[model samples]
Target chain A: MTAMNPKLIALDWGTSSLRGFLMGANGAVLEQRGSPHGITALPEPGTAGFEAAFEALCGEWLDRWPALPVVAGGMVGSSQGWREAPYVRSPADVSRLAAEAMEVPTRRGLSILIAPGVLSHPSGGAPDVMRGEEIQIAGALRLHPQLAERGHFLMPGTHSKWVDVRDGRITGFETYMTGELFAVLCRHSLLGRLMPAEAAAPEVAEAAFTRGVEAARHSRPGDLAHQIFAARTLGLTGEMPAAALRDFLSGLLIGQEVLSALGHSAQADTPLALIGEEGLCRRYAGVLQRFGAVPALQLGNTAPAGLFHFAIAAGRVAAAGEPAR
Target chain B: MTAMNPKLIALDWGTSSLRGFLMGANGAVLEQRGSPHGITALPEPGTAGFEAAFEALCGEWLDRWPALPVVAGGMVGSSQGWREAPYVRSPADVSRLAAEAMEVPTRRGLSILIAPGVLSHPSGGAPDVMRGEEIQIAGALRLHPQLAERGHFLMPGTHSKWVDVRDGRITGFETYMTGELFAVLCRHSLLGRLMPAEAAAPEVAEAAFTRGVEAARHSRPGDLAHQIFAARTLGLTGEMPAAALRDFLSGLLIGQEVLSALGHSAQADTPLALIGEEGLCRRYAGVLQRFGAVPALQLGNTAPAGLFHFAIAAGRVAAAGEPAR
Candidate 1:
């Protein structure tokens, strides 16, 4: 993969981890690098931390490919980041993201363009925001143009994003703290106290999770707040094994996310394009399928391509780097 | 308050605190004492711990009135408590609780009767359980007989309970982890990280809380699982003051609890009874009023009344203590 001429170095830096992708001509992966140092995990405070972490992760690539343009996406561009790439409001597209990208110059003489996050204002509801997911959406659209003009994208992660793209521009999106909620509830809530030992055997996890999704599907919109108590009562009543408590909760939370996200949206029937780690995306796919949502696209790890796409729009990457449809 | 001769010792021994009421005839409080050593706050393990904590809280009263019947309610009767007072399944009433009270004798030559919890099984949903609130309900009903035949009770706390009573029985109930959820999110989640410094001022807390409740009310069901993100976004966008974030979150969580618990229940409109801490009860009462619910009763510290009511039904306390409605 390193044989191609490297064109751009892209980074998807989030709260807890940093991943770097060295892209070649036509958006090919020439090489890749990763670090535990996310925006929240800097070795030092301020620019020095970001620069040192950035250099440590892919400084060799930059040293060898002196002229290579570097770009980053995610929370790395937040206010707490090395430099704030203020959020660009929707409706947006890769071009708008490029236009809003904030350039931070480093001591190494290489200026990195940190992609801005997208903020969506829902009528009659509070505003929503996303950082790195927008870049992934850009890459998804670039790789699958059929999805460019119109698509429903679900990126399941610590903070899941259900994005809507209209006419090749990013229209709007909603955020569900599904992954985060699951983590906190398991680690902090009373129901969580019963999960650990019971979750040891993953054998019954599948069934328990499915049951949770089914329960979520059948419940009313406001039901999940109290309905979650089943994670404990069922175990106490000897109706469910303690071992399945963890999985049952995982299912219930994810199920509730899916139920709320899809049930209230008119565009749910549209084919969904999922972008995230395989396991989480699979869970969402199965749950979405439960709601009769047609499986559309599964585009994973589109960060490099997305950064390349954004850089191209920003006129940083040459058009020749764009892969043909 | 201690001038009257004490006739009974009633204790509300819960997870984190223990309150003992020295009662005279007619359920009058001769004196009262409290301790932080709840069923969960034992200095040691096993019966010894409960015995020690129990004695430490009200040993003088027990010694002064050795023949006075001792009665306790709350988690003290759970499997983790002094003894396992098996749950009396719904439809259950104070009589059932009295009938199911588990008695454990102490080395002090005195016997203590621990009140039982209630288990509610909702159709097509998971089972729900409450160890202490049932006693509170019994007390509430004893204090307001008008509600015994049919009433809706909201006991807001770490685990909020929306209980349904009919024909003098606890027919059903739902538990919402509102207080716990607020705690965990504020202490653990990303949104929580932005709360402390900004929440210094209490002046705007009321408005922020009201806004959160309004948002919860306007949101579709299932939306809360994600709608909670506004606690952060609204702050970030400068739409809401940072100080307001904490209360907003509190309001959102409590409001969501109300929305889900009451939205799906047919008995929600019934004149509602609010039981629990005074402040939390006030919050529930205010939110209930917003939903057009008729506020029926605000019975605080009903445990003494509840324990006495249960003791009477159990034939431990004399009928002379029964307060006439």
Candidate 2:
């Protein structure tokens, strides 16, 4: 039963970094490796660069199991990646995503399974799309089947997503640019001038953050442009130190995002789940706790779990109890 | 009456540029000069820099009228300017601003009157402020006294302000960082990536802008961080060109500011006025018209007019039909 050898190479690639997961027959991670070579961070350009990064991060594993199936997700499957994988329209399920897993033939006669992204078109709005988070959602659903009955999956990161899953199918979702907004404001706006480059002490930062959350939560609709100025004024008034402004901004943005969610999607007595980085998830959890809609499941690195599910469904790999392909 | 020669020197000094106005005995502007030397853009640093900028901008006018009163308003009275003129609390009027003008003694043997800024403490919120706008309000009140009776004065710029005035006094005001937010996001956020560095066709830009304003106006409260993402999505989806994104963003932010104002301050059939740059004020006017609260009075560069009002009140210059001081 020491067959924990890598049965699949799962790669999660994005704008800034790439993470590879060596998954076993049972969808468990056997080993993990990471690289700074994201789709845009390649040592070289185009397919050659992607190939080099892939080799650098997973060459040894590939050398040991030359025929092992490889699955790549995130922006790596976008128009700018090694090979493009088209997005699966919303209301899609596991079979659709698996059926859409693209193949890129390599010189070694190996086919890399590129995960397709998900796109949703809300009436009278621009189409919303996601590539990596789709995989994460699949993994979350695979990890906890009960979560599929009815729930809102909150994935917090550069571009956060609030996904609606019902009867085990993603019916719809929306993307909130909270993290990117926070970064742009803190790095470029006048508000960033007083904020020092250093991090503040924990308890003080948390308190400041909570204050920001409370402010955003209680503010009126269309008040963000008005209220965010407080981040500067509060510091100028000597009510809070510069060190705590970052967290305060974080809490304010997340609080507003949560407030918007409470208006329709994430609500009282409804199932919710948090997925992404641990600290980010914890922050979302804490903010949601304020709204009294605590996430039912908190998971991390669900991309590999999601890929495993897709691979099995696509027949790229056998079932969990069966022998490895 | 040909003595329209400079009777007073008024300078509206702000962060990026300075405007100097030479006034006659009756408060009519005899001449005007502009300098790129704002508080933060002086040729040198500190008082020396400020003095140099002042000398470069007004040395000729001062030489001709050595006894002329020199009055300055805006950031020139900020803590980092020639001298700090502390803020006058809300419920302030022209007389309060005139009476509190601080004089900075210069090596040139002339007293430079600095306008004090206005501050308001909203219950359970951070204090709000405006240094130059108070001067503009004073000018507006002097220009059209009926305006001060009951009106919401909208001052749109990097930081937009909605002032509640009643019975000839500024009762309260709130600041919105709309222009600043739009600038930061378009220059630094992902939304800016697709935006080209050139201007789009005017008619196309205006339509896009109106679309953005409509979106923001219709969005739910706390929905800005969500709605703004459309700036990127709409471009990616080919519903809009990259050139139109800037205008769209401008409209969205202004729409949000207007939305918040209408929520409490700016309402239908109420007296309203706009004081700021012509283009910005026009944008606000357009957005407000969408809400059926068109500005009643629209004025440009009211700071000098404000200075003239303050100068007469402070006895720096003789009133109309009076002899020169």
Candidate 3:
């Protein structure tokens, strides 16, 4: 006989978009739908509007499977979200919510559960914030027990994160605004003049990139302006092409990430796992490899995969204390 | 009586714009004309096109005063200009250029002298290039013979140059892309989102500027990105307003100048003369004062004064240098 339909809704609501799945009790996606709406678009009188939007998007499938538990994640749980999910200090697990997971009562008598985002910050340390991504990380860990043993998980996106998972728990993590900076620099800075509007090719100016990376390693982020001038002069002097300059800029940012990770942890042999766009993911992996960290796994559908793991853990289909696969 | 018509055409052709003053060999302007065209806008044909466009603007004036000797300065003498004006490495002066001026035969039968710009690279140093501005510095030195003994000149603009003039020659200088970077960051970066198209009020975030300057004094220029995130987070935490973040970014760049300058020069009492926009000049003065360098002169019409000094030294004017007040 086929497994029964899952009872919980695993949702990923980010700053610019949202994704949700109606899973069977077995933790497999039964019906899925995503919308353009995001936490940023939520108006004041937050929960009421959020609940209505949430129902309008997922109510049909829910009506068919009545009384399904809904577990949401992402920016929707932020201060501007359906509810302000308080930040959880680092060294947290699946069962812990930074703050009370928000529960919104729908007009249709449906109950909605929103997962709290996590903030992993060491004392006198740089802080990391995640709403839905932490849930995804947790889910990913649950789905892959082997990955939980010891490794670096790079969840790359708008605000890419580097998470360290050890013994089935998120030991710690850091957020690097790599994607955001790249976007802003390419689309908004003088550097943008050289970058084509669309994704074209990955042409690395090894020398320039290496220089930038070295700068990042040795200097703080504020030094980018001077480095930028150096790079521009390189272009002006015909030492590098404009396109190569773009690549060099990207490499500098990635190099900074690699250095930041190294700063946080001294694990040299620890395997690396990358999750994000294939091209960017490969580039990051390349950067890691160049920095001497070999990747162990690369996941393509990080959001859905992580969400699946989350649902299984929440539904008890994957029993607590069971080692992650 | 009005000053006698000066003998030469004093040109200030920079990266973005060009200005010319026609003199009657007496070091006094008879007519003045400025064009949007600059070395940055000139075609690759070099001299041919540059001469054509330049002549179109000042040919008639030259026709009227056929014996006028034209002395040009600025980017028009750069490698990309009408003709390459070889850089006169450190500690060179008007006499140095007098021996190497490019003599261009004009259509109006006038002898045009192109002043060679200064190229200074102290021992194991970064190369700095200056063209028309050097003439102004020369003029300032001529005006103030005492300043020739020792002092610093702050010629702030698109590419602000801080020149160390000693013994009536530019010994060395450092170029800071403060203005250009500010333009790119404000007009092309996310920071632009904070302010409208118009220039913002100067003191919007005096605190961020001061803080950024302090940060720059201690940190390397390569580490700017991390500090940017600090600004962003400050905004996110509601501790810093978005508008103030603009000031902070501005501070970061200017602060880089302060720190970068320290490593180049050892003189603590070298007087600084600011020649640029009054607003930016004021800010730099304040910044320099913070670092313990007080302004000795604040020039309002630097180009004309620079041309005057350069002309007398280049043999276009036979007048002895006057003492600068």
Query: Can you rank all candidates by TM-score, best first?
Result: 2, 1, 3
Candidate with top lDDT is 2
Residue pairs whose backbone atoms clash in candidate 2 = A221-B221
In model 2 chain B, where is the ten-residue run with the lowest total lDDT?
Answer: B261-270
What ordering of candidates by DockQ runs from best to worst? Answer: 2, 1, 3
On TM-score, the leading prediction is 2
On TM-score, who's better, 2 or 3?
2
Give the deviation of candidate 1 from the true structure as CA RMSD: 2.6
**Alpha carbon lDDT of residue A177, candidate 3?**
61
Please give the DockQ score of every candidate, comma-separated.
0.73, 0.79, 0.22
Best by DockQ: 2
- Tens digits of per-residue lDDT, candidate 1, B275-303, equal 87888788888887886776777878788
Model 3 shows how many backbone clashes?
35
Q: Which runs of model 1 end up more than 4 angstroms from their true locations?
A: A1-3, A198-203, A321-325, B1-3, B197-203, B321-325
Alpha-carbon lDDT, every model? 0.84, 0.86, 0.66
